[model samples]
Target: MTTPTSSTVLVPRIRGALAHSDRIVLPQSVLEQLLSEAGRESLPSPLTFRVFNPATNAYTHCGVREFSAPESTVLISPQIASTLGVSEKQLQASSTQDGSTPPVLLVSKCDLPKGTFVSLCPLDTNYLTMDDNWKALLESALQASYTTLTEGQTFSIVNPATREAITLLVNNLQPEKAVCIVETDLTVDITAMSEDHAWKSVAHRDAKRKVESGKVATISQDAPVRGTFSDLSQVFLFDLKSWDRSRPVIVELEVLDAGDSSERDIDGRAADVFVSIDEHPSKDYFLWSTQTDEKNVISIAPSNSFLATAEKITLAVRSCVVPLSFSLMVSQEEGIVEQKSAPAPQSESRQCPNCKQLFPPRTFQLHTAFCERNNLLCPHLGCGRIFRRQDGIPASHWHCDLDSFSCDSVSTKEKHILAHHTLATCVCGESFPSQQHLAHHRATICPQKLHICRFCHLRLPQESRDSQSDLLAGYTGHEFRCGTRTTDCPRCNRIVKLRDLDSHMQLHELQRVSAPLPRICANALCVRVIDDDPAAANSNSLGLCSSCFGPLYSPMHDPTGARLKGRIERRYFIQLTTGCKRSYCTNPACVTGRTNSNLPKLAPAEVAAMVKELTEGGKLEFCVDDGMTRRRRLVNWIGDDNEFARPWICRAVGEVRVGGEDDDPTSSEAKARSWLVENGVRITEVR
Candidate 1:
């Protein structure tokens, strides 16, 4: 669709300009300018140019003999004016400095030989018709062109270059040989419409009473057509372009269904008739009947509250594509129209056992059934007593702990329900009443089944698109690769998901291997000052533990992988005199614990051996804890995974040595004392 190579400056027509009957009088200056625009060596005699009419979609070779006016302008005859979607008065009208008469906007974008039709219809109408009656053509069609026009018939016309179309209309028929000539006003007959478009609007609907030319319009219901009609309430056909009737084009109309006069409601408003997508009686989406403004138009989109995706709607609507015609009837509601409704009676009520409150008899069984099963309390205001199940009846006695249970709660009752009530479980591990429910959930609500566009944040289920060509165009960003994808860190051995590679490369902390020294800050960061750090190692604030003992270190993979020391420090109390176990059970001695029978203490070597046997047998594990401002030991591990450790192991490892400075952490006796208490063992018989 390239543009034409000619530009014309239109000027007003004046009297006594050497204009011929068929030729458009033009000045020499204007003619030369136009020829130059067309890139011609010389102007052709009776020069011809192509013009476009968007409304009637007509494109033909038209000649220009000459032109006129003081300034460079184009003044064509009325016939040419009408063909180009402009009025004759427009080209002939005088232009002031302020442009009293606005210039027509040309649709042509270029000044080339084979030009494009770039003009729009000056008139509001996007459509028009042609007929053979010369007299009538000028009268009705504004002298554009005509073939033949009959009443109550539709015709298709389009601008070949612009593709703008009009479904031509002829409301009433008049035959040449008719013996009887009726004097009634004619109505506008809608012959056909373009495919994939919707039509509505009370103004267009009421034009049915006007002539096919739409010259005369009225609001009367008196004009009769050849049919037995009942106030325009019918399912009209939509002339689909194709023969596939899988999903019909939905007609949305808002109207009031007038009921019998005696059954009218107190408000006198008409009963609204509507269709629901979900089939809920009260949740209707499409209006069945109604009246509105004359300008109201029908919606071409699918029904509201429709669960289908956009692609589904486009495909479904396109499946029933109708390129030719569709049925249309509009009911105008100038004011409120009332309809009557049948009376509805109330149901009988009964009492509840929990609160002795009244409920409808029909709903009482359902109300009590679930309550008794779930141990629910009376929901009535001011009543909190629970209901018990006794022979299918709700017995009262306890209170409801409603907050303690939910659908996901795995209680004894829920376990019993799952094992006994449901026969199958879904892939997501949820129980349903029947296979049908399970299948529906899997198809519609399953998280695993949800399709998300990797290119964007659009989460959608599987569905088709509106146009394959359109889908291919505009965007090339969608990528849908699923499942776990991991890659080894380029710098470190740590593995990371492919998508998180960018963030993983940012870990500067993993670059260094740290061997943490087992020294407390005494700065209150440690739960209890386990022990003061060696001045040399504590200065750098980076090292590994070598002093602590216990199984708390297991499970936690220390990057440095430090091994256990042969002997660890401990709290040892030599017996200066015999004393009760409770006397020493306050601090570190509590780690050793007590028993029903009195026992003697054990040597450190014996205690260490017991610890070795128990831990090696997979009986114990350990971990580490950092201290906080007011609290020490057992900090929450939620922020970091490594903070989780066995509580008993930490208690055993954090021993305050009561021995003389002469004792060393590597001493077998010291290790023995710590291991016994760490395992909560009494040194009794071994001593």
Candidate 2:
């Protein structure tokens, strides 16, 4: 066979995807040329190629990702470019005979050994601080981005959840310096780059914990902290570690001063400030977050799961402008009595009509002259604040023309208009007045919100409920339909709806736990449980099922039980004298079972004596039947101890139950022997 080979210019993949992978893209012309050179209809699957950078004198193996590059130009991933010491400088246009072109790498078809083991070392310890399940995430990232491995090469893996990137260097490889990772089971060992790196990682984690723990403010009952935020990003951490957590604490935030809004537009579009109480430093486990425009006295009871185990409560604030002042108080939920101040003594004064201010009667006229010229009353309805007329209302005091909201600052007015007047539409086609409303609508009530289906295990948009019944049933429309698909229950062998399967299986489990175990057939060789038939439950005396006790059953009555014992004796006599002579018989109590099992059979006189002795005890087992039911019992019993009995039982039950036409007495024994051979039921000698 001819080897396919080609030379092409390698350039770093600047724009498109697979930037972290080792796969490369080649020109379509190169692929066609390689195919023609090999004299084959198609190129081999997962085409492996060796790329050589002549300028750097370096080489690396790669897998083809696509054949859609520009003519004579190959697009190698950044990882591959780094591996071969190729840089973007080589991709710069050069003055050539055909205008401008730069190609500095050679590509050729080659075979590589499959990888068996690899050792990787992370460049830093940032990956150690990731979630505990990050190892699986790393493996997934590696699988998605790599097709080959080489020693001394470095690659980066990005976390999809947090978008954090960590670089790893290939430290060692087994079987070869480079190996094809396609369809190979590789043993991977991951370690920190060095011992010093591990120590630094630990130190970094401890330092972060110390900072967070030290920043938390402790609160006591009835005592509140007055806080001020200079900016929106300011966060206040508090802890109730010293207080009794058993009693619910009410965390209250009273806005003392909203600050000057006209200074600048608020950082957010909603409320001026948002307060939340969370357990985690990241606030991932928040108990409550401000959901409405309740800025006056926002009181939240920290009574959720976070309050039980949280060491610290993080009070995060997101706001529009700075210099915001608020009073944060934590008190017992039931004991908050408002304190009423004593009425202030009435002051003897005269009311000034111009600025609505009370002044001393002595200088009333003089005060009025200055107040009337310098101070001006607000012209807006319900707003009587007086400002200096010379400063032209200060430019900070403004009122909305459309609503009854009047506040200080032009930015606050703009924010109010945007929050209450501007309309926003969600992707689900619902419209809201503000972004905050839209966000809340999408998170809580949107039917198109993505949710994982419990039955189908697929992520899909939640479907609208068909009716109130569906809502009461706690199922989405998708779940209702998905649960309609039926599956056979292995325990009861009954078809049950997926939605009801849990309860049905639970019912079965309850029955199993509460009901008594079924009694085994009286026959020592039989493995069948005694059936609850009329003969087996009411009349049978040996605890045997109808099938096992049917032959000896009769309506004849004997006062002394002599006839019953005689029948049992006769059954044993027949087993010893004629012998069932079947190979599967393994009962140690029966003469036929012993004989077929390679044990010496008793003589006729000895058999008679043994039968008499057994019947004298008023109990005996019938084991001479060659019926299908009897054979099934034996098969089940053997299956418990022998792995090879399953196929034989399957074939034996199928043949006897489904196709029993050959039971013509003369051919019955021959058919049984033939079945033993076909089903591979070996007749082993008794030990």
Measured with C-alpha atoms, the lDDT of residue 209 in candidate 1 is 29
Candidate with best lDDT:
2
Model 1 lDDT on a 0 to 1 scale: 0.33
Residue 191 of model 1: what lDDT?
29
lDDT per residue (tens digit) for residues 1-687 in model 1: 334433445535432222211234445665556666668465433344444454456532344454443344555544345434465455545444555553432323211232211111112244332212212322222112222232222333333212354444333344321111112232323323333222322344455424232221121222211111132222221212221123323322212221221232111111111222211111011222111211113333322333332222111000011111221232323323333564453457776675455677788998776655656554545545444434322321122243222111122223223322445555546767644345344444433333343333333222323345423432212221221356687656678765456546644333221212333322222332343334333332223233322221345545553332221111122211222244323122122232222344455675555545543453221222312211232222211233223222233334443233354434623453344333332222122
TM-scores of all models?
0.17, 0.48
lDDT at position 687, candidate 1: 20
lDDT of 2 by residue, 1-687 (tens): 224356657474544468788888888887777777668467666678888878788888788888897776787777787778755555454223454556578888877888999999888766765655566656656665787887888888775434467889999999998888877888888876788987887798777566432366776668987766675555666665555565555556665554333345332222332333322232121334443333433344445454564555555443345656666676665544344785554488778888777777889999999988798898776787887787777666667787676666555666666656778886657787766666455544456654556786654556677788777777888788778989998667899999888889878756534434345566654444453445576567777767778888779877787787777877788777776666656554566678667788787778777787777765555564455435555456445655334444334433544223344543443454455444333334111
Q: What lDDT does the true structure give each of the candidates?
A: 0.33, 0.63
